[model samples]
Each structure stands twice: as C-alpha cells, then as structure tokens.
Target: MLFRVDPASPVPLGDQIAACVRGAVAEGTAGPGDRLPPARELAGSLGVNMHTVLRGYQKLREEGLIELRRGRGAAVAGGASPGRARLARAARQVAEEGRALGMADEAILGLVRAALAAKGPPPLPGPGDGRP
Candidate 1:
C-alpha cells in the first residue's frame, strides 16, 4: 500500500495518513490479514513524526479497520473489506459533517434513515451476502 501526505494541506498529517490507509482498504489493495508498514518506518518515509503515523493507526483501530498488536505491528481486521471500508469512510464523513453543522445525533440519524428509506429498509448482512 502507498502512503502519501500533503504537508501544506489544512488537514492534520495524521488524518491524511489515516485517509491513505482507508483508501487502500476501500480499493481492495489492502485486505484482511495484510500487515501495514510499521508506524516508525512509515513516519520516516513520509517525513512525519512517528506519533503522527501512530495516531493514524489508532484512528483505524477505532474504526475497526485495523488492529494494533504488541509485537505483530498492525494488520487489517478480519471483518474489514472493500465495501465495508468504503461505507465506513462515507458514514464517518456524514457524521463529521453533521456534527460540524451542529446537528443533533437523532436528527443526523433521522436524515440517514430518510436517505436509506429509499431502499425500503435493508436486512442485516449475513454469511455469503457478498458484502465487502
């Protein structure tokens, strides 16, 4: 997977790093069980602080996209897949924008529900559902 960041961007470097990983996951280039480059190495290569890369990894961990192991470094979580990663990114963007707009959680959820209503309700995905 490739990691790149724009130092001049208004966005934090850590967030940019996280976005790169998310994009890789969504593109199916980095799948479950794939090991991510060590934070220290990635930081060196990207010319950012190690903690910055770590913060990015932590964000992925929070999103359930990747897991940080003691000696094993980081790997994509088993439940993570291209489709799920894509939707997860979209969901996060929606929630962030809603919060930035000062919308209440219920109101935000209601909006999501309304949008989803066009599909007439979705059943929970199960095995062999082909969601990824």
Candidate 2:
C-alpha cells in the first residue's frame, strides 16, 4: 500500500498512516494475507519515526485489519474484507466522534440503529442522458 501523510493537517501522522492502509483495503488494492512493508522501513520512506508506523500498525491491529507477528511482520488479517475494512473504519469514526461529543455508548449505538433504519446516501445515477 502507498502511505501518505500531511504534516500540516490537523490529523495525526499515525492516524494518516493507518488511513492509507484502510483505504487500500477498502479499494481492493490490498486484501487479506497481503504482507505489509516492515514498520522501520516504511517509517524511513515516510520520513516519520518508526514508532509512528508501529502506532499506525497497532491501530490497524485494533481494527482487525492487520496482524502483527514477530519475525513475520504485519499482514492483512485473514478475516479482513474490503467491505469489512471500510465499515470498521467508519464505525470507529462514529464512535470516536460520539465520545468526543460526550455521548454515552448506548446513545451512540442508538444513533447507529436509527441511521440503519433510514434511507442511506442517495444512489449514484448511472447511464443518465440528461444532467451534465
């Protein structure tokens, strides 16, 4: 996966690194069992600290998107699918934002349930002949 970070952005570097992997998985560029570059090496290339890469990897581990093993390094988790990775990342965002807003766990869950019950994002038009 190609990792990138904006040093000036409000988002943390580690989180940006994690986002790269997550996006790769979501877009099917990376998938289950795909081995990732060594954290130390990736850090060198990204010009960030090794621990920053590790922290990103740890976040992926917590999200069940990747696995970390001694000597073997990190690989995409066997259970991770493109859809699952995207959903997991989205869920984490919702939960984090909810917590930041001082929402209780049950309230956050309720919000999710309500959303699930509603019509979702509008479907993209396909083969349209009218609007530009």
Candidate 3:
C-alpha cells in the first residue's frame, strides 16, 4: 500500500493517513483481504508517531473497512470494494454537511430517501462501472 503523510498540513496526521487509505480503497489500489503494513513500519516510513498510524487504522476499523487482529495486524474487511468505499465516504460527507446546516438525522435521512425515490432504483452496474 502507498501511504503518505504531510506533517506540515493543517489536517491531523491520523486523519491524513486514514484519508490516504480510504482513497486507495476507492481507487481499487487497495481491496478486501489485503493486509496493511504494520503500524510501526508505516510510522517509521512516514516519520510519524506510531500511535498516529494506529489511530488511523482504528478509525478504519470502526468504519468496517478493516479488521484489527491481536497479532495479525490490520487487514481490509470483506465487501469493502472501491465502489462501496466511495459511497460510504460520500454518505458521511453528506451527513456531516446536513448536520452542519442544523438538520436532524431523521430530516437528513428523509431527504436521502426522497432523492432515492425520485431517482428510482439505480441502474445495474455495467462492466467497469466507471465510478470515481
């Protein structure tokens, strides 16, 4: 896996790391069942504190994108393909924006439901799907 962190960026290092992994998953460079580099190794390579990488991995774990095993390190969870990862990220962003605008959870969900209803069922994906 290719992970990069910018210590100078305003974004927290842990968040940056998590974002990189998420982007890779969204782009198909990382896929289900793939094992991530050990936290210490990644921390050494990125020149960041080991705990930072762990935090990022923990975040991904919470998102159901990865599973952390006691001695097995972290491995991408099953079913988190590029398309699903992208959708999860987009849904989170949309929820956050709605909350920032003082929308309640039910209200946001209702809007989503309305939008989905208007669009009807999504067309079956074709070969390659071509989503970004």
Per-candidate clashes come to 2, 0, 0
Which 10 successive residues of model 2 have the least lDDT summed?
123-132
Instruction: Please provide, for model 3 over 1-132, each residue's C-alpha lDDT reduced to its tens digit, 9 standing for 90 to 100.
Output: 778888889878998888788888999999999999999999999899999999999988877888899999998889788887787688878887999899999999999976886587776556687742
List the global CA lDDT of all models: 0.91, 0.91, 0.86
Higher-scoring candidate on lDDT, 1 or 3:
1
Best by TM-score: 1
Error of 1 at 32 (Å): 1.0
Clashing residue pairs, backbone N/CA/C < 3 A, model 3? none
lDDT of 1 by residue, 1-132 (tens): 988899999889998998888999999999999999999999888999999999999999999999999999999999999988898799889999999999999999999986776476566667677653
RMSD of each: 7.9, 9.8, 8.6
Clashing pairs for predicted structure model 1, backbone only: 83-132, 84-132
TM-score of each: 0.79, 0.78, 0.73
Candidate 2 local accuracy as lDDT?
A: 0.91
- Candidate 2 Cα outliers beyond 4 Å, as residue runs: 104-132
lDDT string for model 2 (19-91, tens) is 9999999999999999999999999998999999999999999999999999999999999899988898889
